[model samples]
Target: MLDLDDTLFHESDFARSGFAAVGAHLENRLGVSDFASHCERLLKAGSRGRIFDQALAECGHHPTPDLIEELVDIYRSHKPSIQLPRDTVAFLEHVAGLPTALISDGPARMQRNKVVSLGLDKLIDKIVLTGEWPDGYGKPHPRAYGEVMQWSGRIGSDHVYIADNGSKDFIAPRALGWKTVQILRPGRVHDGVAPTAEHEAEFRIASLDEISLRRVLAGSR
Candidate 1:
C-alpha cells in the first residue's frame, strides 16, 4: 500500500498551486503586487480566513465577504497542477505485477482532485480516502488499514505499507503488523520530527529511486 501527500508528491506543491491561483486572483481583484509573500505567510500560518484576513491587512487591502468567498471557492476547487515524478514512475513500472493500494488522509473532494490530477488512480490498484470514512478514520486509525486488508483479502505479514509522515502514517499499520516503510523526501509537510519507536517504520528510503524488490521484501519480512 502507499500514502499520498508527501509520499507520492510534495504536498507543498498542492498548497503552492492553490496559493498561486489565489495570489493571482487576489492581485487581479485587489490590484496588488507581492502576492507571493502573502501566499508564503498563509502557508506558514496554515488557516484560510485568518491568513486571508492577515494577507489583506498586510497588503493594505480591506477584506470583503464576497472576495473571501470567491478565493475560498477557487482554492478548494482549482484544477491542481501536480505531476508524478520520474523516480515514482520507474518504481511503479518496476512493481507492475504487484497489486498496489493508496491510502490517504484529506477531504474527499480535495484528495480525489489530487489523485486525478496526478494520475495516481491509474498507477494504483486500490485507493481509500480515509478522510471520507465515517468519523474520519484516517491515519493512526485502524479502520482504513482494515478496509485495505479486506480489499486485498490479506493481513499481517501479507501486507506492506509505504508512506511518509511517520507521525501518523505508520501507527495503524504497525499495530496491524503490516510492514511499513518511510520514504524520506524533500519538503515534507510534517518535517523535522521522527515517528516514535512504536510508530516508526521498519525501513526507510530516500525516494522511489532507491526502491528495490529485495528491500521491499526484506522490510515486509
Candidate 2:
C-alpha cells in the first residue's frame, strides 16, 4: 500500500498549483492583480488554512461567509498539475502485479482530485480513504488499516505499506502488523524529521531508489 501525498507527489507541488489556481480565481472574479504576495504569505503559514479569508482581507474584501466558501471550494477542487516523481513511477512499475493498495488520509474530494490528476487510479489496485470509510477514520486510526485489509483481502505479513510521514502514517499499519517503510524524498516538506518510536517504520529510506534493498514482499526478492 502507499500514502498519496508526499509518498507519491509532493504536497508542496499541490500547494503551488492550488495557490496559482487561487490567484487566477481571484484575478478573474475580484480584479486582484498582485495576489502572488498573498499566496506567498499563505505558503509560509502552511496548510492553506483560512487562506481565502486572508487573501480577501488583503484585497479589502470583507470575506463574507458565502464568498469564503466559494473560494475554499475552488482551492480544494482545483485540478492540479502534478505527477508522481520519476523514481516513484519506476518504483510503482517494479511493484506491478502486486495487490498494491493506496491508503491515505484527507477529505475525499481533495485527495481524489490528486489521484485523478496523477492518474493513480490506473496504477493502484485499490484505495482506502478516511472520509470514504465508516465514521471517517483517518490514519493512526486502526480502522483505516482495516479498510485496506478488507479491500485488498490481505492481512499482517501479506501487506506492506510505504508512506512518507512517519509521524502518523506508520502508527496504525505497524500496530496492525503490516510491514511499514518510510520514504523521505529529498526536497520534500517533511524531510529530515524522525518518526516517533510509536510511529517508526521498520525501514527508513531516503528515496524510492533505495526501495530495491528492502523489497521483502512475497518472492519479489
Candidate 3:
C-alpha cells in the first residue's frame, strides 16, 4: 500500500497549485493582487492553520469566516497541477505486478481529484480515502489497512505500506502487523520524528528510489 501527498509527490507542489487557484479567484473576484505569493511566503515561513487568513491580512484584506471558507473550498476543489517525480514513477513501475493500494486521508473530493490528477487510478488496484468513512476511521484507526488486507487477500507480514508521515502513517499499518517503510522525501511537509517506538516505521529510506522491492516483499527490515 501507499500514502498520498508527500509519499508519491511533493505536497508543496499541490499547495502551490491550490494557492495559485485561490489567488486567481481572489484577484478575479475581489481584486486582491498577489494573494498566491503571499500564501506561499507564509507557508515557507513555517506558518500553518492560518495561511489563507494571514495572506489575506498581508494583502490588506480582512478575512471573515465566510471568505476563509470560500477560499478553502476553492483551494480544495481546484484541479491540482502536480506530477510524480521520476523516482516515484520508476518505483511504481518496479512494483507494477504487485497488488498496489493507496490509503489517503482528506476530503473525498480533494483526495479523489489528486488521485485522478496523478493518474494513480490507472496504476493502483485499490484506494481508500478515509474521509469517505465516518469520523475516527482515519489514520491510527487501522480501518483502511484492514480494508486493504481484505482487498489484496494478503495477511500480516505480506503487506507492506510505503508512506511519508511517521506520526500517523505507520501506526495503523504497524499495529496490523503490516511492514511499514517511511520515505523521507525532501520538501515533505511532515518531518517530525515519531513520538514513540510503536509510532515509528520498521524501516526508513530517503526516497522511493531507495526501496528494495525484493526485500520489501520479503518483509525484511
Candidate 4:
C-alpha cells in the first residue's frame, strides 16, 4: 500500500505554496511593513497547508504559479520553524517492513528534494512523483493513482491513500476502490468542503502512529 504526504510527512508543500503566495503578495503590495509580520503569523498559525488560502482571503489577493515557486524556494531554505511530529518517524519505522510507496503531487523537483534531504528514500519502498510521469495528471484525476498501481503491480483495492487536503485531490482513487485515510491535522478549518460519503475508506486517524501498518496489509499476505 502507498501513503500520501501527511501519511508520511508532517507538512504539505503544496499547501505551503498557497501561503507563500500570500506572503509574496503582501511583500509586493504592502511593501515590507506590518503586513509582512501579519502574513508570517497567519502562515505559522495554520498547519502549513491552508495558510495561503487564509492569508489570501485576509489580504484579498489571488495566488499565481510564480508566487508559489518563490514560496517553495523560501520554504526550502527556512524549513526549521516547522516541527515534524514525533509520531511521523516512528510510524515510518513501523511500516518499514512492508512494501510501502510514497506517492505525492506538486513540484517534482521540490518533492524529490524533500525525499532525498528528509531521508525518505531510505525508508519507503518507492517514491512516485506524479509530475515525473508522462501524463502529469495529479491526484483526484485517477491517472496518477492508476499509474502508481500499475507500476507497483498492486490492484486499486489493495492500496490506501492518505492526505490532509481537499477531497477533490483524492476523489478519483476512492472511486477506483482504493482505501482512503484522511489525516486529521489540527487547525485545518473546513470551508464547506466535505469528505465524499461514498467509499470513504476503512478508517481515519489523527496520526500515522495510531494505525497499525501490519494490520492493514495483513490482507495482502
Whichever of 1 and 2 has more TM-score, that candidate is 1
Q: Sorted on TM-score, highest at the top, how do the candidates line up?
A: 3, 1, 2, 4
**Cα lDDT for residue 72, candidate 4:** 53
Report the candidate with higher lDDT, 1 versus 2.
1
Question: lDDT tens digits, residues 23-65, model 2?
Answer: 7887898887666567666666663467667777887878899
Cα lDDT tens digits, model 1, 1-221, are 88888788888788888878888877787787776578676666655446666777788888788877787778778889988878888888888889889998877888999999999888899989986778747778888889888899976777888888778888888888888888888756676255578878888887978766565666643
Candidate 4 residues 1-221, lDDT tens each?
44445555555443454345445546775553343445567655653455544555555656566765555566544423233357877877766676777767766675676666566777777787786766647665677677668877877777776666555545777777776666666544432144656534455667766775456545321
Model 3, C-alpha of 192: deviation from truth (Å): 3.7
C-alpha displacement of 9 in model 2, angstroms?
0.5
lDDT of the candidates, in the order given: 0.80, 0.78, 0.90, 0.59
Measured by TM-score, how close is model 3 to the native structure? Answer: 0.97
| Model 4 per-residue lDDT at 73 | 65
Least lDDT summed over 10 consecutive residues: which range in candidate 4? 75-84
The C-alpha stretches of model 1 lying farther than 4 A from their native spots are 41-53, 62-70
Candidate 1's TM-score: 0.86
RMSD of 2: 3.0
- Maximum-TM-score candidate: 3
lDDT of 1: 0.80
Error of 1 at 56 (Å): 2.8
Please report the candidate that would top lDDT against the real structure.
Answer: 3
The residue ranges of model 4 lying beyond 4 angstroms of the native Cα positions read 1-5, 12-37, 44-84, 133-136, 188-195, 214-221
